[model samples]
Every structure is written in structure tokens, then in C-alpha cells.
Target: MSRMKIALAGIGKIARDAHVPALMASDAFELVAAVTRHEPPEGARGFRSISEMKAALPDVAAVSICTPPRGRLQLIAEAFDAGLDVMIEKPPAATLSEARQFADMAARAGCVLFVTWHSRAAAAVEPAKEWLRGKEIKRVEVSWKEDIRIWHPGQSWIWEPGLGAFDAGINAFSVLTHILPGALTVEDAELRFPANKDAPIAADIRLAHAHAAPVLAAFDFDQRGPQTWTIDIETDGGRLALSDGASAMSVDGEPVRLDGGPEYHLLYRQFQALLEDRRSDADLRPFELVADCFLLGRRKLVAPFEDF
Candidate 1:
């Protein structure tokens, strides 16, 4: 199959770090142009917006929307209306309804739409999922703490109404939704919001699933040392641990060998599969879990989080 001429919309950090590099490495995609408000990335010329990019590069067949979660609807809808396939970053839209609308629009346009969960593409995820297929889960604990300064720098959108710690926490949920034996839902959540921001800086969330175990997760954005994204689970059968962002796993306190590799590579491969098969793969489970955290949980105000 010939390479799909694709455009990169949004030149943010993830766009530069993940999407651009993934597309460049994949044989299925040809980086035709880039749409950005700032200086374009390394290889492609910049366009002020997706519309401008589309107008200038009509040959582009697909676009990857890497913009922040807030107000991503219009750009995605516009791309669908223009008859171009789309691939969206995590937390596809602010709400489940809006996300469903995007999926519907893509279906109507008969175009490929991929909503990515990069964490699920990690090396140890599939192994863990296969290991837990029919087992009875007793309990789960997630410690997903990271330094916002190191990862996000000064990007303030994460502190806005929709993103924040959930930006990183959602990756844990992505892995959860992928590896779990059954459907998971938030029983309740305690969201700690900084006195100034509209989003939470830390969250203690309780999650439950039918016939499965209870889950306790703490999503913290103020870690000062080595970042931790680990899951410890106890089952009727044995114990499992997933650390290093689900790139490594262990069973019964014994290390498990996984094909430790880059996740973005797998993500792009899935996107290419969606394009080749003419199908849309948008899983709303992770996004819905975040929305559930906001809806079913109570809010608390904490000291204003000031980054140095």
C-alpha cells in the first residue's frame, strides 16, 4: 500500500515529541505538511491553523489532531467535513457526547478516525491483559504521581477546566480499561483543586467494576522526585505489578519479561491499521472514566499550586 499523505495539526510538545516522530518513522504515512500557530516542527512548513493547512495541502489525505483537549471539537469536525481521515490524541473531547458526535461524523464521512491511548500500546499491557483474562480480581491500587514542571513545562491548558492531573491520570485509566477483565467505573472521587485553577492537582478516586475488585487510585501532579506510574493488583489467583508506565510487569513477586519497546511506535501502527481497514477505532471508556471522576466525585479546594 502507498503511504498516506498526512498533516500534523497542532505543534505542541506531544505533537513534536510523539506524533511527528512516529509519523516520520512509519512507512504507512508521509508527512506532507504541519498546521501550527507557532514555529513549525523540524520537517514541515507551518500553517496558522488546520483550515489553512488543508487549503494549501489538498493532497493530504489524513490529519492527526494533537491539540489540547479544550475546544478540539471544531477542528475535528472541520477535518471530517473536508473528507479527511483523523487521528486524535487522548481525552479526545471534553465530554462523552461530543466524542460520540465526532465518531458519528467520521462514520458519516466514511473516513478513518483513531482515538489513541498510548499507554495501552505499551510493551507489558497486552501481556498483563492476557494474564488476567478470566481471573478474579481482588483489589487494585494505582499510584500515578508525576512532576508537572518536568512533563508539561508552563503549559497552562492542563490546569484549565478539563485536563490537569487527569491528563496524566488518564493514561493509567487507559491501561486499566485495556487490561481489566471487565468494565470499570468510578464509584466516587475526591478531587483536590488548587485554589486558583479550574482543574484538580490531585485526586483520590475509588473505582469499581461488576463482579471484580475495588480500585483505589491517587493521581498526583506535585511529585518532586522520580515519577511513579505503577499498578499493584491482588487476585484470587496471584499478584501482579505493572510499573514503568506499563512497560514492565511482574507476577507473584517474580519479574516478567516483556517486549520493552516504544509505545508511540505501536500507536502509529494501530492508526495505520485503522486507515488500511477503513475503520474507526475510538474507545470512549478512558474519557468516560475521567468524566465519571468529575461527575460522581466531590470537589475540594487546596492551596494554590505554584510551579517553580
Candidate 2:
């Protein structure tokens, strides 16, 4: 099969760290151009805007958007107008309403759209899901604490009005929504916002399901030392734990082997399959969970965050 000519939008940290490497290593797509105001990666051509990239490389059938979710709806609309399949990063849009429009636009344009949750693509996620089948889950506890200085550094957009600790916490929600048996509803939550920032720096969310277990999630972006991303689930069968962002797992104190090498690589593979089948894969449940946190969670003021 011929490789699909593709362009990458946004030349930020994530595009360089994950998307570019995955696209370069992918067998299904060719990275030909980049839509960025700044310099693109070493080999790919760079354009000031998506319009220029589309005009220059009309054969490019797909575009992978790695930009922040603040103004991503416009970028996606431009991609669709250019007649390209779209693949978006996690936490699809700034709001659930904007996220929901991707599918509608894609369907109108007859283009394939994929909104990815990278954590759910981790190796241990599927195996954990398989193990949890037909088991009675007693409770779920998530500790997803990380340093914003290390991960996002000086990204001011993260602390903007629409995102905060939930930016990263949504990954945990995504994995949980994917691996669990049923949908979760937020019961109550306590959100702590930095005095200087509009978004919250920490959140303690309580979630429940109609038939499944209750979930308690603690999310923080102010950790100084070792980072933690762990999900411990107690089931009738035994205790199941996922750590290191679901790249590693252990069931009842026994480690389970993980097969997928990198989450982004697996992510692109799935996107290729979607393009081949002419299908759109956009699941808003994770985004919805995050939305619910903001909707029903109580607010608290905290000390100003000054890591940047």
C-alpha cells in the first residue's frame, strides 16, 4: 500500500517529543510538511499556515494537529477545508461543545477524524481491561501527581481559564473510562486554584457509577520530587494496579508483561487503521468526565504557583 502523505500542525514540545518521532517511524504515513510559524523539524517542510501547506502539498491527505486546545477548532476547520483527515491530541478541545463539533464537521466533509487519548493507548490498559471483565470492583483510587515545571515548563496556556490540573488528570479519566466496565459520574469534587492563575492547581474528585465502584482521584501539579501516576483498583478477584501512566501493571502483586513499545506509536497505528476503514474515532467520554469535574466541583483558593 502507498504511504499517505501527511502534514503536522503545531511545532511545539509534544509535536517534537512524540508526534514527529512516531510519524517518522510509522510505516503507514509520510511526514512531508509542517504547519507552523516557527521552524519545523529537521527534514519536513515548514509553512506559516495550514493554507500554505495545503496549497504547496495538495497531495497531503491527512494532518495531525499537536497544538494546544485553546483555538484548535479553527485549525481543525481549516484542515477539513483543505480536504484532509484529522488527528487531534488529548483533551480534544477547550470545551466539550467544541470537541463535539469535530465529528459533525468531519462527517460533513467526509473526512476521517480521530481524537486520541494517549494514555488509553498504553500497553497495560487493554490487559487491565481484560482482567477486570466480570469482576466486582470494590473501589478505585488514582494518584496522578506531577510537576508542571518538569512537564509543561513555561506553557502559559495550561493555566488559562479552561485547563489546569485537569489537563493532565484527563489522561487518568481517559484510561479509566476505557478500561472500566461502565461510565462514571462525578458525585462531588474539591478544586484548588492557584491565587494568581485562573485554573486549578489541584483537585480531589469523587466519582461513582451506577453498577461499578466508587472512584477517588487526587490530581496535583505542584509535586517537587518523584512524580506519581498510579491507579489502584480493588476488585473481588484481587488488587490491580497500574503505574507509570499505564505502561506497567501488576495484578495481585504480580507484574504483568506489557507489549506495546510507545503509546504514540500505537496511537498512530490506530489512526492509520481508521483512515483505511474511512471511519472516525472520537470518544468524548473522557472529556465529559473532565467537564463534569469543573461543573460540579467546589472551588478553593491556594497559594500562587510560581514554578515558571
Candidate 3:
């Protein structure tokens, strides 16, 4: 089988730490080129833009876009126009409208467009989904708290209005939407914007599902001791907990072990399979929930935050 030639856009932290390693380890993809305004590290095939990369590496069959959500539509549209399959990172696009536009364009072009939600590929996720299938869910709660200063460092785009902690929160919601049995809609929410920034530092969200269960999701970017990424549920079977952002699962307070590996690997494998099968994997339900919250929720101002 011929390996798919792949180009990476936006050689930032995620492109370096996850996508590069996953592509290197996979036999299905070849990392032929990269597009970034910043210089690529030593030995990396570099281009100032996607057009340059495609021109230089004509064999590139696909482009993986790791750019921020706010300015992704133009690049994605360009890639599709160049006749290459595209893979978009989590949250797909900055707004629901952009996501819909990309979906439509990809359909018209008849090219594969994958919107990756890496957390949904966690080892424990499938098992948790299976366990929840027949159970009666009474309530759902998701708490994702971490120190943005430690995780994001000097990155400034996250503080932009369309990005920030909600980005991570959307990832959690993606996994929740995947594992849960039914669709969900945000009922109410509180967005806490830092006094000095355009994006919110924390979000308190309420969701409703057709199962008649009320779901509450809380995301905080200011957590300090023992960083937490967990989801708990009260179901007829028992109390279920998914920690480490769905990397581990427990029921009735008993620990359930899980296999550990880089989640991006699974995502890339899935992407490869989708391309070969001539399928598109674009699910915007998670982002829709977040956008709905933003559209309907009340906002409050909080103390200014600094990256330190």
C-alpha cells in the first residue's frame, strides 16, 4: 500500500508533541512537509505557507491543520481546493457557522475532512460507553480544572475571545457527547471572563438530554493543587466516574484500569481508515453545545488573569 503523504500546518506545541510523533509511528502516513510562519526545527521540511508546502511537495496527499480555531476556515478551504484531504484539530472551527461551511465545502469537493477529538480515542472510553448503554442516567457532572499558566505557558491566542479555557472544555464535552447515550443541549451557563482578557477563565454550564437527566459541566483554568479532569454520573446501575479526561473509568467507587498510550495515535489511525473508506468524520455536536451555551448564557466579569 502506498503511504499517504502528509503536510502539517501550524507547528506549535500540539503539532510537535502529538501529531508529529503519531505520524512518525504510523505506517500509513509520511510527514512530507510543514507550513508555519515560525521556522521549523532542524531537519523538518519547512514552508512559509500551505501553498508553498504543496508546491514544494507535490506528493502531499493530506494536510493536518493544528492551527487555532479562530482562523482555520481559510486554510482548510485552501487545502480542499488544493485537492488534499484535511484533518482539523479539536473544536473544528471557532464558530458553528464556520464548521458548517467547512462541512459543505468538503462535501462539494468529495474529499475527506476529519475533525479530531483526541480524547474520544482514550482506551477507557469505549468501555465506559458500553457500560452506560443500558443504564438509567439520573445526573451527569463534568469538572475540568487546570492551571493555564502551566499548560499553555506564553501562548497568547488562548486569551482571545474565541479561544481560551473553553477550548479545553469543548474537548471534554466532545468526549461526553461521544460516550453518552443521547443528545444534549445546554440549559443554562455562567461564563467568567477575566477582567483583563477577552475570553472566559471559567465556565459553569448546565445541560439537558432526552433521557431526562440534567448534566452540569464546570470548567476552570485557575486550579492549583492536584489538577483534575473528571466526569461523574449517577445512574441506575451505580455511581460512575471517568477521570483523567476519560482515560480511566470507575463504577460503584471501584477502580477500573486502562491501557495507556498517546491518544493521537488512535485518532490518526481512524483518520487513515476513514480516508481509505472514502468517508468524512466531521461531528460538530460538541462545539454546537459550547456555542449554544455562549449564545444563551449570562456572562460575568472576574479578576484579571496573567500567564505568569
> Each candidate's lDDT (Cα)?
0.88, 0.91, 0.87
Model 3 lDDT, residue 154, Cα:
79
State in Å the error of residue 76, model 2: 0.7
The positional error of residue 290 in candidate 2, measured at the CA in angstroms, is 0.8
Candidate 1's clash total is: 0
Clashing pairs in 1: none
Superposition error at 199 for model 3 (Å): 0.7
Q: With candidate 3 superimposed using the best TM-score fit, by how many Å does residue 21's alpha carbon deviate from the native?
A: 1.1
Best by TM-score: 2
Q: What lDDT, from 0 to 1, does candidate 1 have? A: 0.88
TM-scores, all models, native as reference: 0.96, 0.98, 0.96
Q: Which ranges of candidate 3 are over 4 A from the true structure? A: 41-43
For lDDT, the strongest prediction is 2
Clashing residue pairs in candidate 3 (N, C-alpha, C atoms within 3 angstroms):
none
Worst 10 residues of 1 by lDDT: 41-50
Score candidate 2 by TM-score against the native. Answer: 0.98
Off by over 4 Å in 1: none
Candidate 2: regions farther than 4 A off: none
